[model samples]
Structure formats: structure tokens, C-alpha cells
Target: MDANSFLMGGGGAPTAKFPTPGTVVGGHITEPPQVEQQRDIQSGEKKFWNDGNPMMQLVVTVQTDQRDPAIDEDDGKRRIFVKGQMKNAVADAVRAASAKGLEVGGILRVRYTHDGEQKQRGYSAPKQYEAHYTPAAAAQLQNQPAATAPAAPPAQAYGQVPPGVNPVTGEISAQAPAGLDPQQYAAAQQNPNTAALLHQVPPQPGPQAGGEPPF
Candidate 1:
């Protein structure tokens, strides 16, 4: 074909099978409100859409007070459908957030694109959209204080100890443990278990030439 005809008709429309138009949405993720699974009509096999893949619908709480027209202040939230077509996009977003040490509570922005008609075996699937996510920096994340190590539990005062026997030393001084007399208590305090053992003295000879037998 001629160059002009090739340029005009051979290539056909530049956007014959174009990507669906999309919009950007920014918010924090929430649990999905609903889920849907589909099966093929002809073969009765499991089937998914959105470029032949299933999607996860996530409800997101949009950042309010930012005056973004895309966000509905009255609703304060929006929904995003994530699918396999945007797998790399979602992974990149998650990696970005992870690199920043962020998590589910972190802010993210997603580009949502709608799907065209798809029909099979006299069955027509409803229109759907897919999400492509990106990490969104927020003032909240930036201004959050670094987690302090619980202030080291406020170093206990000099003589104030927990109300229990010391596990390491195995010492118990709680009211002398019931049945011991004051002397026994003192002795037990000096040597734990001394009160628990009985001692017996054997008989000794009366005396030696210059020394009394000590018993």
C-alpha cells in the first residue's frame, strides 16, 4: 500500500483497542465490603474479568479536609477494585510504602480504570474497574512522632521492690512465712530452710585431761 493509505487506513484508528479512561483516588485502605466470584457459562469453569483476572474490592477512607473534589466529604470514603492487570502497580506501591516503613494505615493513591463489555456463551458481565496504586505522602505520617521505648519503665526507686520473693536470689521475707518464732524467723532469714531441717547431737565423753568435752 501507498505511504498515505498505510498511515490513514493500514494502521486503522490509533486507539482501536485503547486503554479505558481512569481517575486518580487517594485514601487509606479498609476491609472489603463485598466480594463476587464468577464462573463461565459454557464450560462451567471459574472465570474472572478485568483482563481475564479477578479483582479485590477495597473500601478506602479518603483524607478529608483536603478539599479534593474527587473525594466525597459526605461519604468520607471510596472503593477501589484491584486486579491482576495492575499487579506491578500495586506491588510498586506496597514496596514504596514498605521502604518508608508504612503499612495498612499508610496513605495511598490509586488510578482507577473502567472495563469495556465482555460477553461469553450468552452471558454478559457487568462493567467493572481496576486500580493501580501509588504511595501518597501525608502530613500525618510525616508529623508522627518516632516511637519511644516506653520511657524505660521509670527506673524503680532505691528500696522499692516488687511484692514477691526475688526469683534470682530465692529470698522470701513476707511476714516470716506463718509458723516460725522471732528467733527462728531471724535464723531462717539468715539461712533459708534452716527451720525446715531437724538437727540431732550425738553423746560425747565427759572430759579430757585438761579440756571439757564440747557438745
Candidate 2:
């Protein structure tokens, strides 16, 4: 290769010392009213892309009298935007709200507090704290005789219903149950032998009784 000469004559164009003709990626553009969801790390936001995705966002929802187009979100999802070094803000916010029982649709406002640590209170009181060997309140738990939960429509005892049984209507008590089922209570009543073995409400509806949803 000649140091001074312009053309050393290798027919093909020589490669530039510094990169020339910057790399250009080929992509097809879609028409309006269509979008693809993608994460945006630069702006610390999650968004749906439209067309070639050059713009940050587009007006997705129709304008309503209740809300201005400026604040209306493009999709059904909430506009969860976090800027300035927000890595786990969304996840932390969701967990905190869940711990406090604030659901997704419910409006929850978050305020930070800088309070110093304080005393911790226990759930059971009067006997504010339990000693290492102390027994629980219920005499039945103390006995621990193999028992079943209270049953529904429990057999009436003493013409007046039991603590868990509603006297007027045969409904099981909503409060803590003595036994697991209606049958168990009936068994206890019919054969006094098992009366002391009953332990829970049979018919007060809850997650256990409710059928599971589609997985």
C-alpha cells in the first residue's frame, strides 16, 4: 500500500478507518389503532407501542365527560409510571397495599413516615403475654381429646341451642366454632359420648367450604 497515493487500486471500495454508513435496522410500520406492549427502561415506564414506536404514547381510550384526555389512560391498566431510579417501586407499592388490605380497584394513598421504633403488642391480652407452659383458654383444647368440628343444624340442647347454634333458626354460629360440622354436633347430641369432642361451626360459609375456581 502506497503511503501518499490516493488510489492503490484494489477495485472494491476500501473500508473507512472510522465507521461510515451507520448501522440501520429494517422494520415494518403498522397502521394506527394497534399496539404492542413493551418495557421502557430509559423512562422507567411500561407502555404499549404503536406504529414504529417512535412516540412515547398515544390516546387509546375514547374521551369521556368525566375525565380529560390528558389524564385518561391508553389501556385498561393503570398508568404506573416511575421515573428517577425507580427499580422496584411498583412491586413495593403493590406488596405494601396488599399487606394493608387495599385492593386493586380500591383507591389507596401512600404517605411515608420516619417514626422511630416503638413497643410491640401481642394479639392475646388480659393475660397480655403467655407464659411458656400456659394452656389456651378453651378447656376442650386443654383436654385435646380427639374431636371433630361442629355440624350444621345442630340438635337442640336444653330446648335452648348451644353457644354456636342460633336458637330461633338452626344456623350455626358465625363466631368461633366448637366443632367441625352439623353431623358432629348431631353425633354429640345423640350419643353424649362424643359431646365433648365437637369443635367448629359446620355451615358458616368460608374459603374451605367454597369450591375452587378454574386453575
Residue range 2-85, candidate 1, lDDT tens digits: 356367774211111113456565555433223344445489566666697863432334442234354344344443333444
Worst 10 residues of 2 by lDDT: 126-135
lDDT value, residue 55 of candidate 2: 32
Model 1 regions more than 4 Å off: 1-22, 30-73, 99-103, 112-139, 143-215
Task: Give the per-residue lDDT of model 2 (tens digit) for 166-204.
Answer: 667766554333334554554354455654544332443
Q: For this target, which candidate reaches the highest TM-score against the unseen true structure? A: 1
Q: Where's the lowest-lDDT run of ten residues in candidate 1?
A: 10-19
Q: Alpha-carbon error at 134 in model 1, in Å? A: 7.6
Q: Enumerate residue pairs that collide in model 1.
A: none
- lDDT, residue 78, candidate 1: 43
- What ranges in model 2 sit over 4 Å off? 1-160, 174-180, 199-205, 208-215
